[model samples]
Target: MESGPAIFAGTTFALFGAGLLLWTGARVLHREPVALGVRPSVSLISATLSGVVFLALGVWCFGRM
Candidate 1:
């Protein structure tokens, strides 16, 4: 069985990643602001990638458990 902390961490990571992806998609599609001191396209791509990484990490954690 997984420890409580591990489960909590995995859940948090997954939820944050999902939320980030949704927010990024909504902002990009709606032409809303997404500032990161870089071009909009670059920011969008980076944010999307980060979300993917977080989601992958969360999955990895759960798999380990």
Candidate 2:
């Protein structure tokens, strides 16, 4: 049988990644720093890089399915 749960998880991850990228871009335009809640120190570069990583992970999941 086809894996329904995997498809849902993949879609959720992909959407989260896309939203993170958009949020990071907005912060960049407004000259604000971003944080992932793991540390007190926020940086624009880290936020942008994280967005890319999440996006790549989502794409990879989709490819696996």
Candidate 3:
């Protein structure tokens, strides 16, 4: 399998995760009310986990490359 796709995928995932983290952090810090019945803690935790997963994937992809 070509490594190019892996690298791209990893980078994309990382970027998406980072964006989520930032958005969530902002919402929490701003004390924004929850939308769609979602809890603040849930959003924050999800964002953090997503960021971690993406970071791990990016690292793995970089190693493969």
Candidate 4:
């Protein structure tokens, strides 16, 4: 059923979303450019927005089940 696809896709989306949010926090908090391979001027606001969107999308998918 479509529920199967939703669970699989939603799980994947959530995994990456959590990883992204965690990475963003590490980058912003640690300020280690080498760790994240990002520039010092990286925008935290955008990162937060993207992470939130993905997480919300993932949750919505799971809710469809």
Candidate 5:
């Protein structure tokens, strides 16, 4: 079903996003530089955005089915 795909995609996105958030948080806590050329603040913002997006995706997926 279409809902199956949506749930799978949502779960994948959410897991990846959570992982990124945890990694970024560790980097920030350790005062380490990011792999990308982006600044710390930018990276943090990006991570936060990604986490929010994934969380929203999960909510939407569950809500739909």
Candidate 6:
């Protein structure tokens, strides 16, 4: 069984992941602002990639449960 710290860490990771996923979804729905540091396509691609990474991390953390 996992210890308290591991579980806590996992929850944290999952929360961050969920937040990123929400942002991506909102962006997709055009309810959120687009990325602004670079070209439009590049910003979008980076945001998408980041969202994927966050989601993966969250799932991995949740798996620890």
- Residues 1-65 of candidate 6 have per-residue lDDT tens digits of 66676667767776776777677677868844567566767766777788777767766766766
Candidate 4 vs candidate 5, lDDT winner: 4
Model 1 per-residue lDDT at 23:
93
* Model 1 lDDT tens row, 1-65: 55677788888889989999999999988998666578998888889999998888888778777
- TM-score quality measure for candidate 4: 0.79
Off by over 4 Å in 6: 31-33, 62-65
Top candidate on lDDT is: 1
Best by TM-score: 1
Give the TM-scores of the predictions, in the order they appear: 0.87, 0.72, 0.75, 0.79, 0.76, 0.63
Q: How close is each model in CA RMSD to the real structure? A: 1.5, 3.3, 2.1, 2.7, 1.7, 2.6
Clashing pairs in 5: none
Lowest summed lDDT across 10 adjacent residues in model 2 is found at 33-42
Q: Write the per-residue lDDT of candidate 4 for residues 1-65, one digit (tens) a residue.
A: 87999999899888888988999888777765523455555567667777888888899999999
TM-score of 1: 0.87
| Candidate 5 lowest-lDDT run of ten | 33-42
- Tell me the number of clashing residue pairs for each predicted model: 0, 0, 0, 0, 0, 0
Deviation in Å, model 3, residue 38 alpha carbon: 1.8
lDDT (tens digit, per residue) of candidate 5 on 1-65: 77898888778877877777788778878989755798778877877788778877877776776
What lDDT does each candidate get? 0.85, 0.73, 0.75, 0.79, 0.78, 0.70
- Whose lDDT is higher: candidate 5's or candidate 6's? 5
Q: Candidate 3's residue-wise lDDT over 1-65, tens digit each?
A: 69889889888877877777777677778888434477767766766887778877777777887
